[model samples]
Target: MAMPFFNNMLALLGAIGFWPSVVYFPVEMTIARLNIKKRSLKWLGLESLNFICFLLTLASASAAVRQITQALGQYKPFMYKA
Candidate 1:
């Protein structure tokens, strides 16, 4: 019964929890702690990393949604297909 809501909600929750925790906060803290100058090479690199991580998270979430949709079509609650 809950399977329909499980994967997407899990992905949504994970992205909500992990995006800021893993990506934004750490990068912001690093910039503040080290005082990386704006527009400098190091700052650009860190920002690039931040953007990449964001892209990855977006990709993962989209993949989860896609998989959920695919499985939902093939699935029936409390039934076995294989």
Candidate 2:
């Protein structure tokens, strides 16, 4: 159903290399003429930073989701006293 498709898209977006691939576009274009080694190094550094940012964002989002879910799940039975 639509839920599964949406979940799959999220998972794909959250994959480790996804953001780097998106962020690397400008770097790739700029360095298209560089020697192989230099280009590789530049890409490696850019990708590393991109990935780190992506991971931090993902972690924060996950923590927020967890907190929201925990708060939603909290309940007291004292009203019923059973």
Candidate 3:
């Protein structure tokens, strides 16, 4: 029933939550670091933007994980009316 939907939702959430950290942040940070080493003025702005993006990604990941955990905790096999 809803279990399949929840499972799919969890997978999607995990992908969205982890992809930034795994892919985007590292690449951006590396570029920023290279710019810094080269003494490029754009490095400052790039680093700042990277920081902001990191924070946003972190928040999203945290919320997604929290939601997944809450859903898992509240899951029930069956419900019966009293």
Winner by lDDT: 1
lDDT of each: 0.83, 0.55, 0.65
TM-score of every model versus the real structure: 0.76, 0.44, 0.54
Model 3 alpha-carbon drift over 4 Å, by segment: 2-40, 78-82
User: Candidate 3's residue-wise lDDT over 21-43, tens digit each?
Assistant: 66567757788666555446676
What ranges in model 1 sit over 4 Å off?
1-12
Model 2: how large is the Cα RMSD against the reference? 8.2
Order of all candidates by lDDT, from best down to worst?
1, 3, 2
Provide the lowest-lDDT 10-residue window in model 3.
1-10
Candidate 1, residues 1-82: lDDT per residue as tens digits?
Answer: 6575586768867866677799989999999999999999999999999999888888887877787788778877887555
Model 2 TM-score?
0.44
Candidate with better TM-score, 1 vs 3: 1
